[model samples]
Target: MTAPLLEPPGGRPLRIGSRTSLLATVQARHVAELIHEYAPGVATEIVPIRVSADVWDGDLSRIGGKGAFSKEIDRALVAGEIDVAVHCMKDVPGDVPLAEGTAFGAYLERGDVHDVVVTRDGTPLADLPPGSVVGTGSVRRRAQLGMYRPDLRTERIRGNVDSRLARLNEDGSGYAALILARVGLDRIGETAQPQEVLPLEFHQADEGVVSMVPAVGAGVIGVQARQRDLAVMSLLGGLNHDQTARHILAERSMLHELRGHCNSPIAGYATTTADGAMSLHGMVFNRDGSELVRFHCSGSPDDPAALGSEVAAELLRLGARRLIDATGG
Candidate 1:
């Protein structure tokens, strides 16, 4: 027999896992708020965990850190220590690497995913003076910028969103800009610093929707207490942005096929028409972002993932594979 959805478990509150970071906590609270608004009677408990990626002195460039922020919470999920864990979708690894029996329950509506340029002077990228060094931790940003201005240099940066912004806001004489996540900026209310946010449709890789990319089955927060956790699922799934899911599915599949790594200079986006026809766009670039190959495929949302994979194969045939091998990403 299954327990009631909102039965006054008056005994104990349901626990949800969250990271110890301020931003992670904020995301958890956002998720919790949604639950409280929709699912009555069930209380949420926050389980904070530490992750290695929170290094105080480690160089993000040297660590090759992928999923550094998510591994610990994922472990807690797999171990049955927490009911659900909230996460940033892009931070999720290409493959859900968690133990069986544990899965992501559903996705929250996504946020923007474009890389933004935050210049201290609020100047556009094109206006940056010569020899301007751009601060960014992402190779994608580095490559994209390189494509536009090979004269610009990429400086390795590390830390939470706040910390990165601090570095950008701080003087790096000759430093013209920093690449940041549009979602992060909006979440923290700091979108004013950058002169412009790239529109994914206009800029090869710009700001756009987010998607829940949980470890396998964890696409949504795995509100698992028992097999019939339907009420919890319904409340959250009701928030699923269908277009976001289609975009992410196609993007993830493309990443999987192209072997897109954390450091790979890869970009993908999906958009939909009023009639619901889905158009998927993806690209693979060399480390310098100088050599880029783009491909697009359209289909019904029914098989966006297949469409993504098909385009990826076409990209590979056109020489994207050689660039990946050369970059070792």
Candidate 2:
């Protein structure tokens, strides 16, 4: 039986906060759609807010790392200007806790966790010429690229997905390729055909040679609201996917324990099995990817946090701390 829809006070539409980017807007609208599906009579309004990270063209670490992406929207949410804030889980910093008054209301089902390499001439990553330059802003991606093809070079590229693609397509951009999250492309409807889509498996012959470990919370959308707003929390709870939440909880547990930041060359992913077990895979790398520390652990899905912590502890014991500290994380 369907419960009565809980409309906001005074019958006002819930204002959904989002970064003023096309991709962010799309994600915000998707959340609105989910709300409508969950409660046919409830209303939602997406409010676009420009964040510091959008205007800052320099290194993100200089301006509080990836947290810059959500600070403004979080402020608006806390100030009661917005009812909910939509965020890409990967953009949410793990080194610190969420804002004092904010809490994640729900996490949508996960998307494609693998990354894709886009080349101008449709050349595969392995086929790229030596000394070719790949473009990315993530230290993790840069390190992994170095591990996969030491002969290649990487240049930092930052902007919205479309702008990055534009830069890659420009003449003399010097970007032989750009590595992007597959889910980001899918969200903005930009991924028609990519040169090479990397897989999540580790050295699986049929998938690909390079095993690209995804960032914690990659390919997930998190909806956050005031921790004290019981009504809003109740409305969003219906949208949460239990399996995805478990996986994310495990991954985030490891990230939080490791204190990974934007500049940190850290990657972790979590998966669940049909038998109610979960496993977390974690890795830390040096800036140039010349060295790596990897660990994996499995446990009951009911205690995902413990499994993630176990993996993180093992990785740290294997000297991941040295690599992370070297990057100033």
lDDT winner among the candidates? 2
- Number of the top TM-score candidate: 2
Candidate 1 structure quality by residue, lDDT tens digits, 1-329 = 23246542445666778878667777788777767766656688888888767774454334444667676777787666776777766666563343455555556655655556788767877777778887876666677777667777788776787877776666544456777776666776766675466555434333322111111111222232222455545545654566667667777787778876666667667768778888777777788876878777888888988888888898898888887778763
**What are the Cα lDDT values of the candidates?**
0.65, 0.88
Flag clash pairs in model 2: none
Clashes of each: 12, 0
Residues 242-329, model 2: lDDT tens digits: 8899999999999889888889988899988677689889999999888889988889989888998999999989998888888884
- Residue 325, model 2: Cα distance from true site in angstroms: 0.6
* Runs with alpha carbons beyond 4 Å of true place in candidate 2: 1-5, 204-208
Taking all chains together, each candidate's TM-score versus the true structure is 0.84, 0.96
Model 2 accuracy (lDDT, Cα):
0.88
